[model samples]
Target: MMRRSLTATPGPARLRISLAAQQNGCASGATEVTSARAAIATAQAGLTAAAAADTAARTRYLAATQAVAGARKTMLRVQRQRPYRSARVAHAKSAVAIVTKTMITRRAQSGKATAALTAARTGLSIATTRLAGATSRWKTTCAAVKVTQQKLTGTAPTAELTARAAAISRDVVTQVRATFTTADATTVYGITVHRSVAFAFQRMIDDAKADGIVLSGGGFRTRQRQIELRKINGCPDISTAPASSCRVPTAIPGRSLHEIGLAVDITSGGKTLTAKSAGFAWLKAHADEYGFANLPSEPWHWSITGS
Candidate 1:
């Protein structure tokens, strides 16, 4: 009798299906890793570019500083020489006048006086030329000094441009770091929050979800991230603008509760949470029991202390 096969062989269709599933699983994992690495590389590139720009700006600033110093020195030296140049011109004019008077008074020695007068006039002409040249040099030096000073510290275009560039470079550095941190964070209630607050935040989300309300988005921002948001919202610096006029009230970097990992920005189904929203109302009624309180001015913002 022929021996029978002990195991059943999978049909072609089943084999194909199993292979496809395995491939899909591997592809998904690989794709996720690849995308994360790409994001990291992009963030790194942005940081590098920002750093280079900052270096260039600093170099320009240093060069401008040196230029201003040199220009000021030259200007001072020229300024100090001004009185001397004026005196030389005045003396030349006086000498010419004295020679003419002598020629008018001395008629017997007229030839001698005429020769002396001609020599004095020639000397006067040379002195006047030297004075004019000195005056021109002084004026040019003064203008150069002014231009350099403006470049160094004034609200001149060059100064403004460099200042703005420096600020942008700093902001870029912050943004890149923020991006990386946010990417690495875990999600809580569809919102990216720091690991420390995930449990509490999730509880809040679950409680709200049970009440037929969905909480979404917001939590634990880095200082740099806060700065970027502040800029986008056009929020005035708390140090400068009055509190009443600020449309988006954002705290400065070190002062924000988000930086400490205790705050979250709550929303309802991808919409901003406001006083009128059911989610906001639920938060107001029950969030305090979970150690969360809404910021009065910002309905979407909640913190441990509600400040």
Candidate 2:
């Protein structure tokens, strides 16, 4: 299967493509797991055959022992007669030892057959377990496939789709002049973040402080601020250039997570967190616990999502 990665920031079409690719991989895995059913059937057949052979060997051993007993009794009865030296009597005496040896040999054969049967049973058990695991994985992945399908499916009319997208944008980006309105903002450790994330952000900071790792950061930039930062940072395009393309790695207007009040450029001792910073290490270890994820490209940039 071909593996495709999602773009740094996926648009709606890219999102659909990534999900469809995932669905294809999932369906392929499902197909591969179904082959385990054939292995299970094969193992069961081997067990059945081994069991039948072991049963036959055991029955043969039992019959051989019974034969030896009958021969011994016949030989004893013949020896009690005056003409005990007869050929028939001698043969009966010989038959007892011969049948006894045969019984011993059959016993050894039965033991070997039983060992083979045990091995077969173990093989069946292993195959059963393998099948079960594969089946479970198949179910889980196929369920994931269903989710990807849901993600890829575009059932809404084009007009409704555009309208809904616009509506969502309006809900998320309520303004462009300044930071989020008071109703949407909450203060956390001197930084204003989305109200939904404020509690977690504060808790993370308090916990970090307890660990002797001071946490401070900037958050919640307005679209105007984003544009200003872009110009200051020398982004190629005012609105479309990637953050990574800017001279100072600044996001373009409307593209900055800061505009959403979900991202923060964390600092320690009033300096941005770096790879060597203790505060960065602490966040790496514990930030996810508070629903914060770091963007790998910028160690100091953290948000509800890593992007």
Candidate 3:
């Protein structure tokens, strides 16, 4: 046998069978590789989607943290302002109280000072009134004495006139002494006086008695009798010792005229006499010649010569 033909030629049917088997195997392998590639792509797409979701969540957390921090800062600022506002209110209240207290104290002091000033003014007014009245009487008696003295200038004292004057003094004293018998008159009236003033009172009483002018009630038989005499003689209104003494207490012991002499408070022709007197007015015109003068209040009071 020829060396056997190792390369055998396939008939047409066997070749067809070989080609069919080869095509079937190739199609199966292609299908498996495509399925694996598709699976890989799907896994990659899933990983990308999960990463994107994680990034979005992180961004939102950062924004929320910033908002919280902003809110905390605003709260701290409000807290800081609270104490300052309270302090301001307290200071305002204290200032108002201090001003109110000061105003009240000043008002009280002003009221007290005003009251004291008013009282001082009242005392001064009373003292002024007393001094003015005393000065008015003194001028009147002096005028009457001057006129009386002029009338007597050319004529000397007649024995009858001297007798009459002496009797007048005696009569006046007799009447006045009876009224003065009470304890108060003796204590206040005769406690202090000049010796000459006492002599004048005695002489006047003696003179009035001699003239038959009896002074039953302290140099007045009646007020009406004295008034008639005053009208006839053109005599002025007369006040007596209680109204006419010097208000000031005597500086010298027993020096006041009112204390010893009967105070003859008289005016001339219904008016006070001047220091210069008209003629024939014994209490005014001849008072000095007979040792008499105008007492401070009682214008008609006289003293003895050289008293």
Error of 3 at 76 (Å): 28
Candidate 2 achieves a global lDDT of: 0.74
Supply candidate 3's per-residue lDDT for 205: 37
**Cα TM-score per model:** 0.38, 0.44, 0.26
Give residue 156's error in model 1 in angstroms: 64
Error of 1 at 110 (Å): 99
Residue 260 in model 3: lDDT: 36
Q: How far in Å is the alpha carbon of 306 misplaced in model 1?
A: 0.5
Q: Best-fitting candidate, measured by lDDT?
A: 2
Clashes of 1: 0
- What's the C-alpha lDDT at position 158 in model 2? 45
lDDT tens digits by residue: candidate 3, 1-307: 0001011234423433443343344334434445545544554454455445445544544454454455455445554665557555555555545544554554454444445444444434443343333333322333333343343433434454444555555564455544542232321122223332433343333344444432211221234444344444443333322222323212122222233334333333445433454412444433444344444433333333112
lDDT values, one for every candidate? 0.56, 0.74, 0.39
C-alpha lDDT of residue 277 in model 3: 41
Question: Which ranges in model 1 have alpha carbons more than 4 Å from their true place?
Answer: 1-186, 238-245
